[model samples]
Target: MRRSKTILLSLSAAVFITGCSIKPEPLLPKDIKSSVKKDLQLLSNIVKPITKAITLEEAIDRAVNNNIRNRVQKMESALAYKQIDMVYYDMLPSLAANAGYSVRDNYAASASTSFTNGQPDQISGTPSYSVSQDKERTTTDVSFNWNILDFGLSYVRAKQQSDKYLMAKENEKKVTQNIIQEVRRTYYQTVSADALLKRIVPMKDEVKDALVQSRKVKLQRVSSPMEALSYQRELLEVLRSLQSLERNLMNAKLELSELMGLKPGTKFELSEKVRKNYDLPEIKMALEDMEKVALENRPEVLESRYKERISSKETTTAILKMLPGINLNAGINYNDSDYLLNNDWASYGASVSWNLINIFKGNTYNKIAKTQIELAKEQKLAVSMAVLSQVHLSIVNFKQAKKEYELSKEYLDVAEEIFNLTEVGNDLNMNSRLVFIKEKLNYILSTLRHSSSYANVQNSYGRIFASLGTYSDMKKEEVKAKKVEKKLVKKIMPAVEKKEMKSPTFKTYGIATSNLNVRAEASLDSEVKYVLEKNKKVEILKTISIKNDVWSKIEDGYVSSTFLEIQTTEVK
Candidate 1:
């Protein structure tokens, strides 16, 4: 009764302490200010400086290396792998060691009576009392326990978690593919805007001035009211289009900056060659091969396969849980007691336990396991169908993008001729500029359309690559660049590089830029083995960087990777 009162009082004290401690606590303004300050500092320090104009290859590398989304996916995969370790530990036997000290106001006492023929007799000395325990004592217990049924269930669960880690990796791959697609689309748009913004800005200024003057002319009645109104209306339409186009171009710059994981309003440049010209990506792989590889590398399909494995293992777990549990326990114990004969002891035993209630629920558990397996299978089938549809749609869209780009190119050619003819006739002046502004607007509009069409073609091309799930080329360049100083960089033209001491599993190819030199070694001074004329296809063995320049090892010699396209290839 005394011990029960102590325990109740302790519980009440704990409740009182908890009640005293509890209160609504939110971030004060000062705390929020500090947090924001730290975050801003981290953002500024995290990104590498844009040392030079970024190429398409370099931009993709930055997105992969510095983008928070990619970093989070990688960390999540690492976390899942660590969780597998946690699950494996669950299969291990539990061991516990506990030592306790206690004090009491009175000793543990007991008295006994003996009876013979229904008559009770007390021992000599009247008030009989015996004490076996002291008021203060210490105890130590070390125990080991293992349950066979629980171990089996934990082992099955560990297997499922192992597959979950692999699924995380597959999801990471999917995120990387999407990032690459986004990089390609934005990189070109940024480049085109950089080149055309100069023309756009001047043209916009002139139109704004023209609109202001025309409004003044309308107010002064310098011309017929209808003519002046019509002129002002034309100027307004031109100004609106110019402003809209400029806004879009500016938006493209910001989007590219963000995609490359740079700070807002960060200044950077793109390579001169790419800024001045559009390098169309080419995929020479057969459609059937493309489809075949898509099945092999697509993250959705791989993740689905892992889910099927997990579901199968879960059924095993269900069955393991229904069996009888056999618990094995062993312990060593020690205690200090003045009246005890032995102060230390060792014990070991096993106990088998069965839950009779679970026997009746066996059928229900089996049905649930079976249903989980079916769901996994159905989901796998759905993912496969979706992947196939994406690959086919990407190809069709790519072709249409190319056709549209070609048509835009033709229109640009005609517009260029008209602009040149007007310039040759000296038909442009402050007064006539507004009269010819429509002609100039058509020409500039054609230029923007041509640039946009090509960017779309590039975007569609990258989408097909992303859908097919090929990032080997980009990954190799990032690694190769890191070998120089251990960061994602491709200051030299980025090309796919892999070690090839022996024949590789698949063939990779590249095209020559103008006249390419195949050197005896990866250096400018090395003897030229042969020259590859412009646009000749070369089978790439591997690529490596010496200093900052990159070189691709062809069948017999090395060629500079600066002029070669890396991301698109025939994977056979």
Candidate 2:
């Protein structure tokens, strides 16, 4: 029985030690690198080879959620919220506990004796100096302090913090606006690249066919050798153009993927097709009204306004520095010479303090503060001017892009008609091969130009909306406005749903280890389960149940799964 108890105790100890010794999993280099490389390659393939079938709104949503810079700004904004909360309670009283112990080798006690009228006066006993002695002291104190008043200085400081918080909020808005513009621009570029590729590939095939025909005709003595050579040169040129377009397409894909914060080399197929027609909204408002809107809605303008308020508060704080600071303090202290029950002392007193003589020495700081106020005013003006200038530029570009899109559409139609006529003439032997080729080239150029012009106009519209600080508002308004007009435009488009592949699942295991190198036999299974592949990327997600921690009583937020692709095998 004693032996069995000993064995049981040993086993229990071993289990406890193993359970407590468990460490987090270390990073696996080979696996991580391989996974990252695979993810990047997959991204590259998608963007470079796949057709895009994602909408602009979807792209923007992805960018906002995934873009690194945008995410950083979002985090900063969140941190600022906490800081705002902290500053809001700055006026509250603070309490602190302190304890200390000290040992001294030398201690002295002294008293002075005074003689009145040539006679020595003594009370209780004669005053005498004591020999050095060791002393030990220990003290514990609880203190509380509150700033009752500071001539509006605390108020000014709080206001400054509030303004800073507001500025941070506006900065977040600015980042969001910038992100929307970037996503829209990149989406347009991707579409343009796709359109150009479509045109160039067909043109290349046509040129190649023409070259082959020319070679056959020359060999049969139906055409001159020089003509055949010219056709071959044209084919080579067309091939070079195709190569350039392919390179451009690849670059556009890479840029779009980067903007969307996909792993480098990720593939994307644009879901939105290029549309040629855009109904330009009439600008009925005067420039002043536009400026007013910008001032009212622009995040940068709001930031600048907040900065001005911050500057005003800073100036007030600096001026307050010139005033003398006064503080009232009173505290009770207890002292005892012996550790036991004798020689105890207690005292309490109030004290006042003032620093009145530094005024002459620190006038320079006050002067600098005044100068800063002026500088801040100038900066505010500069920001306002820049905002107005940008708004003007955006308006001008919007008009220009619209006009170019219109012209390109008309030119494309004309070019298409001419090319058709030339093809028919060639069929009847009434047109030369060179004329036919030139007409074909003209059609290709027209199509490319029209596509590019349309993209440019769309991007310009996005910019204008961004500059007007109306992108988000416009997005909301568009949804509302389209509902009433849905019947009229119902035939213009059809809704398409995207299909996604099923994600893979993996099981997690918990292992116990007593030492770093040796595993223990005792292990407990955890009931927690987490989805690892939510985003289709290789990021790990760990979830713990509320019952596992001290804050188990409080409801925790839902843990989403994160997915990472490990490898891709080519299927035969």
Candidate 3:
């Protein structure tokens, strides 16, 4: 009894010391950490403004790397790998170690006691108090268990998880291809709209001025009423068309900004000259051959095939679940109860168990698994057919777009010629100013149409690549290098060109990583006196370190160094 008390006191004191040394549980749930981190990131993005002019290649890179949908797909692929790890671990035997203590409400006692040497130890037939086994006991156990059926099921699950990971990768590729397609299409449209607007704006202003002048002449009776009204109506029609084009221009720019992960209304210039000669390259593959390649490479088809494989595995898993399983168990136990004959013991055994009831019910599960496998196969076939159709339709559309673009070029050329002739006639007093203006409007409209047609042709080409499931293979550097080589060969020029430019002399410069607040003071908590746009270059006068972060003093104010990157540039 004294030894038992000593052990109990020692254990209690150790537990008390350990409990005091350990940190308390978190006040908030552990899951909130991810949410908090994500929220901070979101806040940072919201405060940042995009200030760089993104190139085509840069835009595609950003879309693939930073777009939320693509990020989610990447996370899903990571999650699938984690799941495979979990299921694989489940296939291993389970091992557990545990310790426990228990005490009765009242001390365990017996109703009978040893007889004493008196006439009668009390009432002979009456019960007497007696000591019993220890009322409090402590137990320590270590156990290992393995069930064959569980391990088999876990193996199947692990295989399915691996397939899911592959499917996720394929899905991400599909998404990337789709995003690239959208980026290319929207970029072309945005650039075309910008070019069209440049032409439309001046023409629109001229038409407006003409209408105003014509109204004045009509009011003075200097111009014929019918002629004035007809000219005015024509100008109105041109203005309406210009207004519609302007609306489309805004929408296209907005969409391009969104795809490039820039804020809406962000403005930048495009290299329109590169788009002037986007003709379809020669196609040597036959339609049937293209279809075969698409079937073999398309992500959707591949994903469907993986799904079918997973379904088949699931069927095997279900069958295994219904089979009798052999379970092997081993344990070591320690007990501190006085009543126990053996205080420490080790046990090892194996047993086989079968759920007899599942024999009747498992048929339902088997049918379900079989049906799922069939469904997966059917879906795969459907995807294959759809992919073939997409390939054929894309080819037809590419051909049509090419034809239309070529015809538009011819139309634009004719319109330009007519406009030039009208100008000559007006100079010779053979045509009215109104006729010149009208012909000029026609030429501009033709130019716009041609530009739009060119964009359509490019889009059709992109669609063809997308249909082939091979758009991702198109490298931007190759295309850019080709364009550069052509330009260099065609237009050799001197290195020093005449230009009116300003060069700022600075000790050093820093590039802003976000829309940093340029405060009058160095502290971030200070008032935001001015906001520096993200990715903008600022001349740094000096830098000072506070804690682990640095603050840069610019010409205007101070900004955090954490958001600035030093840059070197040459002054001509």
TM-score of candidate 2 on Cα atoms, chains taken together: 0.64
Q: After superposition, which runs of candidate 1 have C-alpha atoms over 4 Å from their true positions?
A: 1-22, 25-31, 114-126, 272-279, 422-432, 473-572
* C-alpha RMSD (angstroms) for model 1: 18.4
Q: Give the TM-scores of the predictions, in the order they appear.
A: 0.77, 0.64, 0.69
lDDT against the true structure, per candidate, is 0.76, 0.60, 0.74
* Candidate with maximal lDDT: 1
lDDT of 3 by residue, 1-572 (tens): 67778988999999999989998676576569878888766744742354665566666676676666677788888888788888899999999999999876467776744477754355457666676467788999999999989998888888988999999999988988888888878877777777666666667777788788878878998768997788788778878877887887768878776666654555666554423344344455699888988998899999999999999987787788779989999999999878778999999999999999878768888999999999999999999999999999999998999899899878875775565444322321112657767776677667667878877877787787788887655553226333333332211001012111122221357899899899998887888887899999987766565644567778888988777776534434
Model 2 CA deviation exceeding 4 Å by range: 1-53, 85-94, 102-137, 145-154, 205-229, 261-271, 275-278, 284-286, 330-357, 361-366, 427-438, 477-572
In Å, residue 36's CA in model 1 sits off its true spot by: 3.1
> Model 1 shows how many backbone clashes?
0
- Candidates arranged by TM-score, highest first: 1, 3, 2
Worst 10 residues of 3 by lDDT: 492-501
lDDT of 1 by residue, 1-572 (tens): 78879998999999999999999999899999999999988888788888887877888889989888899999999999999999999999999999999987777888878898898886667667889889999999999999999999898888889999999999998998888888878887886787667677777777787778777777887778888777778878988888888888888879888877888978888873222134455667798888888888889999999999888876677677679999999999999987788899999999999997787787788888888889999998898889889989998998999888889878876775454333222223334556557667787777778878878987887777677777775345334432123343222101101112212223456687689988999999999988888888887766565655768788889988877754323236
Model 3, residue 208: distance off in Å is 2.7
Supply the global lDDT for candidate 3: 0.74
lDDT of 2 by residue, 1-572 (tens): 57767988999999999999999997799999999999777655432233456777778877777777887898888887787677667655555556667765446555557789998777556557654323777665555555444635667777788788788888888988888887777787787777566655656676677667667777897657776677677666766766776787767778877777787755558875555454544445587887878878888878877877776666566666666654533333333446445333333333444555646635776677677778777887888888888889988998998899889989976775555444322321212555766666666667667777867766776676677776776566434432122233211101111011111222222121111111111112333333223322222122222322211110122221111122322223
lDDT, candidate 1, equals 0.76
